[model samples]
Target chain A: MKVIKITAVWCSACLIMNKRWKEIEKDYDVETISYDLDFDEDEVKEYEVGEKLPVFIFLDGDKEIGRLIGEKSLEEIKKYIEELN
Target chain B: MKKLLKYILVFLFFFCFLVNVNAKEKVTLYFFHGDGCPHCAAETTELIKDLEKRDDIKVVKYEVWHNQENSAFLDKVMAVYKTKTGIPYNVIGDTAIVGYNEANKFEIERALEYYKEHNDKYRDVVKLIKEGKEVKINDHYSKQDDKTDKDTTITIPFIGEFNVKNISVGSAAVLIGLVDGFNPCAMWVLLFLITALIGLKNRKRMILLGSIFLLTSGLVYFLIMFSWLNIIISVSTSILFRTLIGLFAIGAGIYNLYAYIKNRNQDDGCDVVDEKKRKTIISRIKKFTREKSLIIAILGIMALAISVNIVELLCSAGLPLVFSELLAINNITGMKAVVYDLIYVIFFMLDDFIVFFIAVKTMDVIGFSTKINKYSHLIGGIIMLLLGILLIFAPGIIMFNF
Candidate 1:
């Protein structure tokens, strides 16, 4: 499973969530790809997020599984991932 | 040997004389200020700025409300010197100077000169402490000397590693929360909740359900606002941000003032209502409970409450942002951020609960009619206006020069 976490330098919520995601990834078969939204315009467009940074797009074998936006709890993200599986 | 002893005695006499002439008087200047008083705030700022420039004098500031002795003294001073209002008053030696005018400055200078004249008396007192000698402080010196031997000698317990940024940010968040909770705008929500509860047939259930609903609504409001705090702080310095906040506050204030005026006009004209009409209104409200589900009704009430003060909420959202930004720069960790947010939300809800209960009790005592329950809207509006004004002017008014 490929979990691409797109965020900016100044996005504090993203940084905090990223820290939690790192801990969670240690237990799951998750490949996390982080990108700076300010610089990576092509990556942001690829995710279909119009100017919205700090969005998590979960992909399972080239198919888009789910996407979560805004500041979400680790539990909420975990639940979303579990439902996808 | 006798000649050598005489020479040493002369040298000792000359050394003592030089020490007396060169001794610096340790003058402790104390300033007291209030939270809301503009003049007091200005005086304190000026005094602080002035003290920073002077190495010879030291200023000890005590917020009147926070300090028991200062508060008591302030009360006494208020009673004794009726003309002396606001802060930055200087109590030098025996005299007091109120305001930051030239006259006050001259008076303060005179007092300082008098203190210098009698500097020899206090010199021994200060010297004893400096020399590590046990000095008994009498009442005369104690009144002027804000610092005692114990104060200078005792070491305060260090709670954590000293971090300036953390402390500043933490304090700013707390201050913002306090200001938000205290805002008159929040008062109206409490008023409406109380009136609505009292109007309900099942008073106990209504109170409980209403409190829960209001608390939940408050939580939702807090979370939404807290989440947006970082965004606000990130872009706070922008002109667009300032204008949005300013306009929102002013607009809310105007709306509230209009509502209050309209309500006042209605109250003056209406004295009697037909019994049938009153009964119909009561029946309609009663139907709300019988026909609608409790969960739906709670949601409906929450929606109604939130809708009425949407502007106020928007304005308050700015506070958390300002606070969070201030905190974030101080390296406030994720855990501390959660704790600070929780504290703010809890305090905010508690304040609402208190105001709600008070308004309910007041209405009950006065025996306000069910038909006039809508008057709570007017109260809420007035609170909004006051809060808007406070938000708009508080910082500037507080820092105004005397």
Candidate 2:
């Protein structure tokens, strides 16, 4: 599974989830592509990130299955990835 | 030659004589106002009357919003006075009064009294700056904030006239408080707790435990908002800070709107807490039920309430921040401010109270429909959007002109 993460520097949730996502990467066999809401505007906008922060979009070879928005614990992140698989 | 010398000496004496302005000399009040601002317009009318009647204080008016010079001068005087932003601002001596109301009028009268009595110490700092002279600020007068005109005054648009009164902010407190009560996080905990409480055979323990939880939640709400109020009041909030909060509001509003749209198919859930935290809360609830010691159970409930509300606070950060910022901008403080926060806390707890009461009487948990919470996000989104825009462009309206 591929994860497209949309985050912003200013969002507290995004900052929080950033650490959790890194930990998730250590356990899960997922390619996580991160894009900043501001600096990487064009790419982030394509995802239609309609507010909230630290968006994690799960993809099955670019066909999006689901997305999670906002801060989540490491276990929750792992649970989502496992469910997706 | 002697007559000529005597004439020159007399002229010199006359010039130096009145230079030392007597105690009765009128105190100059430099008022920086906005032309279309409700508070400024309302204050202007009252100050004009004071100008007409009072011989000891002279009101100098500068229309800042429409005039470049006045606006720039406002910056200069603000630098000297160290007054925080939000207007209908008055610079009286070294003291800066940020808003106008009846409470402020009393403070102004008192300030004028002080300056008049201590005329030798009085300096027209604004005038000195206007004259391109160096000004040294030596005294700090009352740091007290005062109110504007009447208790309920209305103003005609573009007319710059108002008799004024105060009601709108209190109304805002009630309205915002009521709406803000429909928070997902706060509701979620109470829902979870009620199911636990309803299973209890002893109504007294149920009542005691439930009341403790709700009271703790309400206290946390009050303390948090009150602390924000104090921080905003104490910190000299610059335009930059206001702009940042404005941006945050807009961001939060957009997020709320997004939540409203996205949650159409999803269930009402707490996104802020993890499964581990949820389990911990559940375990704690179980302990509260199993504990034979009443004191231990009460303490546990209190701890649970405090912890739950802290997370709830995270989920519902937008309203309290906005509410406190609103209070600061409107210059609503002291006992009036305490009362406002109380109104907010009571209203915030209204839903939780109703839910708890219903659960006790009927021995069943009652929850608000998800639709209500959904629609609230939509409405809340719109209000926050408006407040955010006003906070940036026209803050005086946020001061509640109507």
Candidate 3:
């Protein structure tokens, strides 16, 4: 599965979750695409992200599957990934 | 042997002459002044123009009122001096003269003489400033420095001349208050309260309940600031406490600055209040606006105001705290400090007033544009950073204005 991560420079939650995202990539063998809300606005707009920041979109190929908003703990993120699988 | 002795005596004579020339070199005196200010203008057209004739002093002029770059450079100079922010400020050698007068002119000359007498080579502060080099404040300069910033003195038709401290402190209060009012945390609560009030179709009840709610919020804010003022005053003497507070301001400043950049493309929002707490507040608001009795409704409104203010303080980005600390450090105590805090709260409630008044008049609920909050955060962040740096490094200097 591929995950599209939308983050911003000012979002503390987003910064905190970045290391966890790396760990998740190693554990689940997933490809990740990261986009900054400001610098990558054109690409981020295609996903229609919500008000809150640090969005993670789980995808199969180019088609979207599910997404999560805000800061999720390691266990919760892992569980969500497992559920998606 | 006689011819060799003559050559050595001649060499020593020229060497001493060179060292004396270096010590008494033509010194560059940096004069930063504003155009419209009377004292500075007179100093420029009269004193500076006269000083230009002197061979030993080089007068470098910077008109700060119209020039942005010069104004910024002025701030850099004042920050280095660790002195109060005011114009008509003069810097030469290691000496800085803040306000200008007949007596200060003599003091300037004396400073020139002192630096010429004390060292073999004079330190050109203006050159150091231009080079962006770190200029150290000399202890001898500090001790002999009786020309510290006197603050800008203003003249009135009836009042004659007076210090500009009150005006500066008042302006700071207003500016800080307005920024604090744009706080997203409190704005959300006010919007929610407005929505609940609109549920009451009765105009009289809506106005009464809304006004009381605003009053309670203002009162709570005042008390909070006053408490901080007392606490800061108690610990104001401690260097460690002052430094810590300065560091906290700097930290909060960085957080706000990062927030400004992070939300550049995003909307103004409250990330502090979670979904659970939000739902609870919504339920409480609904219950308050639906109360059967008048007294119970008023009590409910007060309760909502209290709780909302508490939450706002938690996420207010330290505007009120910084303001109270300013008053504490400046030694503005008793009734005078209370008056300043009152002025702050009144302005802090300005947005709420405008929103409520408009909603009551037109029967439409509206809030300030999201852009305003974004800009306020940017400005607030910068001001906090400057104040924090000044507070940490220049504690003894009386801060009149930024």
Candidate 4:
């Protein structure tokens, strides 16, 4: 499974996720990519991301499946990943 | 022949001095009196006799009781001066005498002399009276133009020539500011702050943090307005800028409407701030609380407030953009522009103020914020949608004069 994280440097919430993302990478055997809303406009547009930041899109080989927004615990995310697999 | 010429030249010099004195010394007294009032009649008689003996006093009588025009003129004048309601009213230069009596004779004489001595203040008003033009004490009051059956238009300081239309530019600024005040981006930041601070169970900390946050938001908003003002004033005439603003409004409107539709039945409301961001915000706030000192936490929050503006702009920039653009287009400037911007900021912060007050005073802010969070999307969506349509299709409705 692959995860796309949408974020911005100015967003405190996004910064929090950035720290968590590093931990998530260490724990999970999943590919992760973080996109900044300010500079990565092309990717943001391509993925149909809105103004909200710190969004995680779970993808199954380029096929968009589910999305999580705001703050969710690492355990809950792992549960979702397990369920998806 | 030389002796005759010298006598003639001395006579001419004396004559010129007398003419100059007459021109500079005469003072006009505007007497608004009721025709049938015995006191007014007596005062008029006494005034006429006094005027016959003196060459410096000029009386301009308006019978308030008999003539509609005179009555209206008197009302206008009284309104301007905010004087006591009465007939027998007298205005000489800057001084006003409310009633006539034995004691007031001295006042009348003194005012006449005072006006003659300082005629500059009353020169324009007196000229307007002489020309049968309404004395403009208040700019908002309309004057009827008999030629067109419309209100006589005057060139207002910032808004150019007065257009007799639905709303004035000043009023439009207020309305747009009101709408912009309800912006969801601001709401998101405020709610996040309240919720974060409330969890600590410290009312003092909450109040301190909330205050710093709000103060910073207000300051940043004001600075942004100044920047927008400069841009608008310098390049307001460009049609492309207006067109871009119109397009931006439309885009923002559609986005909000879409959010509303998607989240109509959902309890979470608009997902402008995704869950990951919300969690991150919570974590950061927790970090702040864990700071070694409360003062450091507060200072950290202030910095947080400033940084939040950039992210908030993504969702809330539309309304302010439209408002500032309209202000620029209307040519509102100088202190007037500053006043309008102040009004805008006041209204914009009103919601935050209310929430902060509730949170700090009650210390139960999280539940209240949660309840409001439910309807934020729908309300913001509808308002933005309507405003957006107005901007794209008929900006004149929002701005009054396009």
Candidate 5:
């Protein structure tokens, strides 16, 4: 199973969440695709984000599986990961 | 020969008389100041020293509380004037100097100028008072009963007083806030959120989650900081404390930039799994929980956010405490602790909230996090560098004149 983790450079919470996700990836095969919002207008619009950042979306074979918004703890993300597994 | 001697003696006598008259300017400069106020004392000392060297200016110093004769005058005047404080005021001729130091200097100058211009007029009034003569109400000098000119009728408490130092602090805080908001450290945090949110396949969920995260992080940071401020104020004076805070801000700015540059080159190089694998993994995580439980996630993220903004928050907390300490040390009592802390926190938060809102809005509008990624390190570097340099050097700049 592959997991895609999207992130940005400047978000403190995102940077933190990214670290947690990376740790999770150590045990699980997760594919993290990081994007800078400054350069990716289309991707941002496709997500229909209002004025918030550091959103996490879980997709399974082009189907929406789960979504996490805002800053989340490592344990919370782990729980989400467990659910998916 | 007799006529010539007599004429010369008369001319000499006239000349001598004129010289004596000119030398005795008799311009009494009354400086009213409080014993408890540091700035007032400083101003008083400076004024006394400056006047002592000048032959034309006669300085008469009055303590508002100690001078019983002037108490009635002060009360009568203050009863009509609307201002901050009634006592510990200055009256140089007709000009009133309130506050201390630079403010008193300006007021003194204005009063001296007025005395120079209206010397004869004020002399006449003084003569009447000394002779116990009944003086009539005039345009320039009016009785307390006259209220014709509404504009002039309003009682000024500390009219003609200038508190330049205090005013400067206020202006500086605003400038610092502006700089802080635009600082690289803050910008980096904003950029990260924007980029991360944009990458989500489910756009709505991404936006919702992102907004929640940013808001909660900001709220938590400010709340904790404000609470800490209350704790600090209980121990120190606000003015000295604020100066220390300013120094710390500069330090933090420098550190933030340094950290950003140090970590710029590090990469974990974790391989990206294919879309199929990513989806399968996401589905498995989804199957575990239907309701999104972000409490744990929020806490974790909050910790990260705190780590990133620890410097900034500390600086923020320091500023209010320092200012409060300064005010307290200056013997500005009567301000309730809660009210004082509340005002400081409100002002501090007002500055931060504006920055946070702008950052979030800009990211949402731009639609991509690439810009954030590109400039994060650079912004962080510059902000930290500038802040550090400013903090370290500002005290020297302030003390240089001394």
Candidate 6:
């Protein structure tokens, strides 16, 4: 599974997610791609990211499957991943 | 032999010169004035101007309007002199000159001259105060040296002249009130009451009920204090009774300290009310409030208030008892006693007001109330312990004079 994390340097909520994302990736063996909302606007636009930074776009191959917005706990993210079928 | 005698005479001459130089007699006059008082400001300026030329006279001006501590000190000075009046008050040696006038200024200068000649009179007072004894001017310093042999009692303001020990009544009231205000039992009862009221969803009713509860609590507390006051006035001269009260304070303080240490981690205990008793009261309140009639509900609320007051007094009675005991020793009576009781109740209700106001407005958004409730024991315990020890050992600390 490919997970794209949309974030910004100034976003506090995004910084929080960045911390949990590191631990989640190490434990779950998942591939995570981080895109900056400001500098990497092209990738963000390509993925149809909204004004909200700190969102996670889950994808299988090139097609977007689901997304988690705002702040989510490790369990919440895990639950969303399982439901992505 | 002649040369040695000449050297000895010269040495003696220099020694006497040094002694005379040191004996210039430096007097520090305390001038307590209020802020924005035209008379005080003018008087202070004049006093300073007059004293500026004399290096031997040092002026210490305490602004009493904005400073409660300074104001309290002023009150202490007044009480000692047996003068009840306003400020621009000056204290020099044994002389306390109230209000700055031409005559008073002359009187102050004359007094200063007298003290310079007989500096030994007030020097002991200055030394005692420097050593942190709760020495007051009218009581300790102003008296004639010849009368010292006869004077046995020491007068401290607010607490008055007690045979056993000296403590201030006002500061004691504040400290005990603050500690009592944070009683876990009282806080629990308040929280319970608020939660029940919130369920009813009527803000008006909640306000009415809360006001009644608080007023009734105050009334019950005042009644207890009134009776205590009567008892105290009758036996105000009893030194043994005063000592017994002091012992009681020490014991109460120890219990609080022990309770805090024992239940440092518990959710529902702070020695103010036991867990079992608290649960029982809460259950009873729920059942009592479930009734539908307005008059019956009002009566139920009053009953709850009375019961909660009793429980709070049980758990947190140490400070109030200490307050009453202090009052008893001070010989407070008539309207003065009544006034002090009112002031004490105001301070006692301060915490309840803050907690309930916040609870009603924000509904405990930060869960701060819970956290305070958890640590109330530790905070209350420490205060009580210090107060208790002071009551037993050095009661001067109770007045905050040092």
Which one wins on DockQ? 5
Arranged by lDDT with the best first, the candidates are 3, 2, 4, 6, 1, 5
Query: Which lDDT tens digits does candidate 5 get at residues B189-237?
Result: 4343444544444455445554554555455554554455444433222
lDDT string for model 3 (A1-85, tens) is: 8899997543445655776788888888898999976568689989987777678999999988988776667898999999998
Taking all chains together, the TM-score of candidate 4 against the true structure is 0.45
Q: How many residue pairs clash in model 1?
A: 1
Candidate 4 segments exceeding 4 Å error: A1-85, B1-175, B186-189, B199-201, B265-272, B366-402
Clash number for every model? 1, 14, 0, 8, 55, 0
Which candidate model has the greater lDDT, 1 or 3? Answer: 3
Q: Taking chain A by itself, what TM-score does each prediction score?
A: 0.86, 0.94, 0.96, 0.85, 0.78, 0.89
lDDT of 6 by residue, B287-314 (tens): 6556677678778788888877876677
Scored by lDDT, the top model is: 3
* Lowest summed lDDT window (length 10), candidate 5 chain B: B142-151
Q: What digit string (tens of lDDT, one per residue) describes model 2 on residues B15-45? A: 7776754434668887877766777777778
Candidate 1: clashing pairs of residues: B40-B87
Q: What digit string (tens of lDDT, one per residue) describes model 4 on residues B195-252?
A: 6677778777778777988998888887788688767655443334555776777777
Residue B254 lDDT in candidate 1:
65
Candidate achieving higher DockQ, 1 or 5:
5
The iRMS of the candidates, in order, is: 23.5, 12.6, 11.8, 7.9, 12.9, 18.5
The C-alpha local distance difference test score for the whole of candidate 6 amounts to 0.63
Provide the overall lDDT of each model, using Cα atoms, as 2-decimal numbers.
0.51, 0.74, 0.75, 0.63, 0.46, 0.63
Which residue segments of model 6 deviate by more than 4 Å?
Answer: A1-85, B1-168, B263-280, B287-290, B362-402
Please report the TM-score between candidate 5 and the true structure.
0.33
lDDT score for residue B179 of model 1: 49
